[model samples]
Target: MCHTGGCCILRRNRAGRRMTLSTQTTAPYPSLARACTVVLILFATAVLAYTDRQVLSLLVDPIRHDLHISDTQMSLLLGTAFAAIYGVAGVPLGFLADRTSRRNLIVAGVLIWSVGTLMCAVAPSFAMLFVGRVVVGLGEAVLSPAAISLISDTFEPKRRGLAVGTFFTGIAVGIGGSILIGGGVLDLVRDGLFAATPVAHWAQWRLVLLAVGLPSMLWALLLLVIKEPVRRHDQVFEENLPPAAGQNSLFPILRRMAPVFLVVAVASMVDNAVGAWAPSLLIRQFGMDPAKVGVELGLLLMLGYGGGMLAGGALADRFAIWRGRNGKIELCCLAVVATLPAAVMINSHSASGVMFAVPIYFALSAVVTASGLSAILDATPNRMRGRAMAISFFLNVAIGAGFGPTAVALAGDHVFGPGAGLGPAISFTVVVSYLLAALVLAAAIRTRRS
Candidate 1:
């Protein structure tokens, strides 16, 4: 007999006796208040992860002076070193999430990355620092696949866009918070607040890394309190079935979702490229103080990118109801196209002009990013969500994080002539990446329709 929360089925056992099969073995759906709390914790954890990850951007000049590294080498520290491990580890971790306690996985990941961050603070050489970053990447690789899978099971399918969107805002805040906090810490160090402390002899950049890394350890303990929701079953039979070949593997799903994956990869490439270089661009081209740029850029990102995540989430939910599968991809395409113009504006000669353009660029990028993720969740079933997210993470870090910063640096050092062409190089990278993203998203739309 059917019931409110679940159903019971009558079955014949091997002995030919009647049996009742109940689908209520797992916990019931969480209360609204409980769900909100889960999302809040996830959001905060994401903020911490990204803050630790992106803080290096503001520390670029300081690190270079001490270690004598080139832009390309720094970019490797920024992108490839971290991404190589992050991308590779994500797949196995993702599958583990599918079979294990996601909460525990997240807690362990948080502790790991936090330790890695501390390692970066003490590293005396470039190679050691790169190793530290790789460790950080390994820890962070556990978050998205597990977190997204958790959220998907926590909320109903229809509301998932908003939930996922809210979680991603942590990225906006984390990115912004890193700069804001980094800059504030730098100011304090310069003002002699730590002059009397034991860390007085430490470099200003190392202190910043130490400060950000410490909080995450405490946060990891807090994550221990969150309960893991039961995994949801697919409502449609077809969704639960294997491919036409009857093989239980991820290959068919991956092939089917290639265009969607490419869209995410391309979007991440531009987003990371812009983020990694914007601080440097301002310092190099406009000669603004790093502290001041941090405060300003941090505010812009928190407001612009954060707002974009919320709006994109709301819009994606609405679009899903209004237009079905095609809606989210359409939104992505529009956002990608809009991003091109704002990207070109990064080359603006005046500081004010660039400032005006940056928030708009970030907001649009957030729209694409947030909506694109929602689309992926919409397309995949619950059983495969973790691995699906892992594939996306692998591609995102491998292609986007792996190459984004290096591409900009290479263009600056080689094509634009060492120190002077950062502004133009940023613009060039953004335009090319977005153009490719738009094409892939268009193809994704067509594939969905057919």
Candidate 2:
């Protein structure tokens, strides 16, 4: 039976040995229940942030009509404006997560993003709404780096990929949830679902943002229960470091990560581009409604990547063990080979053709994540893990999230301006991104520790 938030309790019987579970971090069968609880909290945070982030896209037509803005202006607000600042802010937050209490930072970020969502809901002008989006990005900057670091500390390498994969499920689910839920909300408000409230149809979108954005406040409570894992002590390996050297500095870690970072950034860019542009492409080209788009994408991701991520991690780890190779290397090579088809399928003309392509794309995308994340974490010392994630995130966001969609949007507007379909244009752009990703990831695979 599904509990609150759809949690299910699974029981195993082995020679009549009974296992009881609690949601705590302490070991010797440390609470799987507690681990799931923390994951649930992180999932909620991802859901809230991602949902509100994309709400602007769904509401773009309405916002443009109400505020009288141009597509170039909308592109600016969506891309460079938010991304520039987010890239700058993410590094410092990443450093802080490494040096300080990650859980506390995550809690604060949740609150910050929630308020930003509320601001978006009530914004009066395009500039004000842009400010809200920027705030949301800034706050969200804290999450992934910190969350990755925490997962690294809390779980061992063998199982860490699956853990990270599970966390990212929040992202897939959140995006899909936003599209599906936001569409329904918009329809209701537009159709006067709450006509007695005396609010404008556009203003009702704000209420939707506020309602979906606030649940993270309750999720913040998960931090209180998670026990902070001990930071790895250099003293434990005194010979590894010079006696006079400082412990917290990350330059050493960054130096080691240079090659790996290049791969992570490019691969992630391809992934984000496919995600950001797919909805708009389908809508503009295929004439699908927002709700249908959301449901289809959400179900695809849930079944494909959402579930595949967990399986990929397990399989990669096993493959690594079987071949006596690094899991990261195996995973990267697999992703490169697997994703090539998805890139081709995206450009397919028929709707049925593209529909069949979805699972391949998602599954390939899912494999890259868990392995890449584990590799990055393994490459850095505990003190530098947060910064490494931050740097990785900055590159991914700036290139992938920022430039990916911006490029697609610009292509759609200029190259495919009138009669040219969005599917061809987006497909062209996404394929280029994926090709670049495959090359970079191949480089990463070659460099993996033997």
Best by lDDT: 1
Highest TM-score: give the candidate number. 1
Off by over 4 Å in 1: 1-26, 235-249
* Cα RMSD for candidates in order: 6.0, 8.6
lDDT of 2 by residue, 1-450 (tens): 221222323433222322221121223323566666666777767776677666666655556677788666676666665577679999999988877887888888877777777787788888997888788788889998888777766664445556777777776566556666666666666576656664444465566676556665566676567666554321111123332222445666555555556656655566555665566666666777755666576556556765656666676666655643355656665676677767777766766666567656877766776566556654455446677788988987787667766776677778777467556666667566666766765665566542
Candidate 1 has its poorest 10 consecutive residues by lDDT at 237-246
Error of 1 at 276 (Å): 0.6
Q: Total backbone clashes of model 2?
A: 1
Model 2 misplaced regions, further than 4 Å: 1-32, 155-161, 187-194, 198-204, 216-253, 323-327, 414-417, 443-450
How badly does each model clash, as a count of residue pairs? Answer: 0, 1
Error of 1 at 368 (Å): 1.1
